[model samples]
Target: MARPENVKFGVLGKNIGYSLSPKIHKAVFEVLGIQAEYDLINFSKTDLSKADIDEIKHQYKGFNVTIPFKEKIMPFLDEVTEDAWKIGAVNTVRVETKGLVGYNTDYIGFRVSLERAFDWPIESAIVLGTGGAAKMAVAVLKDLKVRTIFTVTREKGGILGTQTLSYERLEALCPRTDLLINATPIGSVQYKDQMPISEALLKKQKGVFDMVYVPEKTKLLQLAETLNIPRINGFNMLLIQAVAAESIWLERELDVMALVEAIGPKCK
Candidate 1:
């Protein structure tokens, strides 16, 4: 027998055929014993610009946003949490009578995962890409007291108001970078075996964190492993953030460990 949709939830993104979010959330719901449905609301880049957020509010109680849509979905939201507002990205949205409210848990996830993965002091970091995830990464890195933060993007000039640099500059800055984070989709499932930065540059960092978890070990993390640099994948970050979002949607804290045990393996 199939369960009726007592509660609704999902993720919104473009080209998300490989997303494991459904599995992760479903597992969380199961462990928490909540009857809900999680689905993928796929949209093309062209479609995202003209997204009908009203339809979303009518359909879901809460939802997760991803990729190009993370920042693009903001204008459609009625209110954004302080962290989301500061980061200029919203990965989670809760529907209320006041309209849709946006929140960004990527920062919490990134911060928690880093604390578990490394104990050394981080004075500086080089973050790749300038998307919503990158913004969250920068925020968390700054919170960790990383004074010098550098962002690398393909854009020739400024990106999201951060001091941006071209990929060409990465090689030179890598030596001085204590931590390197890949917040782009460059090493995603579609771009398998691709690295955001060069292997030589990657070797210079004391630690590397790649926010793409689909493959579990992105090429960037693989390169870090080869160089003996401490590396952490995005799986823990994804799980932690997803759990945090669920807590917000349900208005209560969830049994995170139970959900992690159930969905952690599926993320890989």
Candidate 2:
């Protein structure tokens, strides 16, 4: 199919006005000389239904899923790629002639971002939280041959492969953890000052990565900086994922470096 003149795409989530996806994608289209419009669709939890799914499928070219919808939207998809199935989440969806297919570009994004941040191979990592983002991180870590141990909250103990970690356990794990990842929204804008691990734990880590990108340098990264530990923000992951999503939508490979150069100033 030829590219449509009026291409429409969006990022869907609840309270998604804080997202930078639209800006990032719009800039990419503009730089590539493609006529496309990118926007955000904010839907409450109850608003997600078969009707809503059909409406999006009928109207849009593709859309990026986030937050509470990543997992919830899975049931609505006609087919899901292997990675998305393994991760148990869908962050990118396409409206194909056959049906809507779900794919997880988040895993690719996270892996590339982590590798770019640190040239050395990751041997072991402590992933905080067990949400959709954490699942994607786990998939990426597994692909990269990194040993990952999940740290869950005390209340949600015994969450399968996860180990319940109290403040004391975090203190012990921090020193041995080569990569500390905050997959929870603890350091997000609404939940500022809320960190999954204690400051003492961060003090001993070698590197830290946060999936929250709104405030480029999250509290976790700030603490890592103070401790002289190498830290990476989530924007790089977001950028790389956007590229993968665009490739899925356009059915062509894009120059990632060119797209990054076009959106570098804006992403910051």
Candidate 3:
């Protein structure tokens, strides 16, 4: 199908007025010579009902989902990819005449982030939090042949694989952990000045990757830098995943990493 003269897109989530999605998406569309408008569809006022979702599907070509809603938006979507179904989350959605189709580009985003950011071997990793983001983060690590573990508020079993530790137990694996992938939003606006791991544990890691981009340099990444541990932020992950989602939304495969370099300054 030929695209329309002008179309709409958005990032859907709570307290997202600070999101760089609109900048990134609009820049991509402008470069591709497509007329489009992207907005921040915040659901912080009231609950996001099925009716609100139905309305959004009709209003825009597609949209991106963020924290707190990545999993919640799944049931409302018409079709979810096998990977997304397995991950139990949806960060990107495309509006089809049939219905909304959901896909999780977060794994691809994080995978590419690791590929570009880290050049060393990752023998083991501890992913913080067991939420949707952590699931895909763990999935990426498992695919890379890294022994992965999970840390949540409490100990639990059979959650992606055997190994769920409480926050206090995180330091025990510090010696063996090559990478610390913080999939939790602990260092975001809501939890500013807070990180899940101890300074000692953070200093022991070979590297760190924090998936909180809003602050750009989150407290976790800040401490990692203070300790002289090489680190990367989620800003690139944010851009890369938007490219992955665009590939789904616009019906074409664009190079995720290559596009990131091109879409660089526009995100500011």
The total of clashing pairs for model 1 equals 0
Listed in order, each prediction's TM-score against the native is: 0.92, 0.91, 0.93
TM-score of 3: 0.93
Could you tell me which 10 consecutive residues in candidate 3 have the lowest summed lDDT? Answer: 150-159
How well does candidate 2 score on lDDT at residue 95?
89
Question: Model 1: per-residue lDDT, tens digit, 1-268?
Answer: 2224588999999889898889888888777788999999887663454346878888999999999888888898889988789888999999887889999987778888989898988887888888788888888876777777888888764444356888987776555677888889988987988878887787778888888888878888877888788999888988988998998898886676567767787655
Candidates' lDDT values, in order?
Answer: 0.83, 0.81, 0.83
Candidate 3: where are CA atoms >4 Å away?
Answer: 45-47, 154-158, 172-175
Best by TM-score: 3
* Candidate 2 C-alpha lDDT tens digits along 54-117: 9888879999999878888999999999879988889999988899999999988898889888
Cα deviation at 169, candidate 3, in Å, is 2.5
